[model samples]
Target: MTDITSTELKQRQSAGNAPTIIDVRETWENEEGRIEGSQNIPLGTLPDKLDELEALKDQEIVVHCKGGGRSASAKAFLVQHGFKNVRNLLGGFQGYQQA
Candidate 1:
């Protein structure tokens, strides 16, 4: 899986080349704040939601969570499931905030 820095992601968004951002954090965690336009799909529910994401397999997907761990797992899972353009948000949401 590829890794995308928060700064790089921010630049891409500003340039209007936004990838689909998937937040793998829990619902409560997402209630705090999230990158604009990101979709919430907790890591635990991802497997059951695979069909919902099938159409996006060929598109760029950026995954993140409260920290980096969960997103990393999500990225790996997507890749294993044949997602061709999946990326992990380096440092996750906290890092995005700092960036």
Candidate 2:
């Protein structure tokens, strides 16, 4: 799996090559604040939501949580499910905010 820093993500976004962002934080956490255009699918629901993301299998998918841990797990899960390009957003939402 690849590790993407928030700054790199922002740069890619500005370049019009942004990857699909999947937020793994819970509802409440997401309600507070999140990166624009990110999809909220909490880690717990990822298994069930995998089908919804089938179209992204061959695309670059970047996963994030409040912190890095959960997103790492989420990335692993996607890789196991045959996602060709999955990445963990290093430092997650907090890092994005800082960026």
Candidate 3:
């Protein structure tokens, strides 16, 4: 799936149709700021959280990090693990903040 821009994310959030958003940053980084309602799953921990996330396999999941790098890896990891609809958040939280 194509990455979602911060602007596009904000629009969906405002409309109350936002997808399941996962913040793939360190816990402290996520505590600094995060899109409301986004869950923190930190990139490195995604593998450990697979069972917990199993129910969401076919659901649309949006992943973000401090910038965009980690989230890209997270998206790829989830896809490799049988996730059918995972997307990266373009520019990540920094871009979302700027937007």
The C-alpha lDDT values of all candidates are 0.95, 0.93, 0.94
- On the 0 to 100 scale, the lDDT of residue 49 in model 3 is 99
Candidate 1 residue spans exceeding 4 A from truth: none
Per-residue lDDT of candidate 1, residues 1-99 (tens digit): 569999999999999999999999999999999899999999999999999999999999999998799999999999999999999999899999999
Candidate 3 lDDT over residue span 15-99, tens digit each: 9999999999999998888889999998888899999999999999999998999999999999999999999999999999999
Model 3, which residues run further than 4 Å from truth? none
Alpha carbon deviation, residue 80, candidate 1 (Å): 0.7
Error of 1 at 19 (Å): 0.2
Top of the candidates by lDDT: 1
The model with the greater lDDT, 2 or 3, is: 3
Indicate the worst ten consecutive residues by lDDT in candidate 1: 1-10
TM-score of each: 0.97, 0.96, 0.98
Instruction: Please give the ranking of all candidate structures by lDDT, highest first, separated by commas.
Output: 1, 3, 2
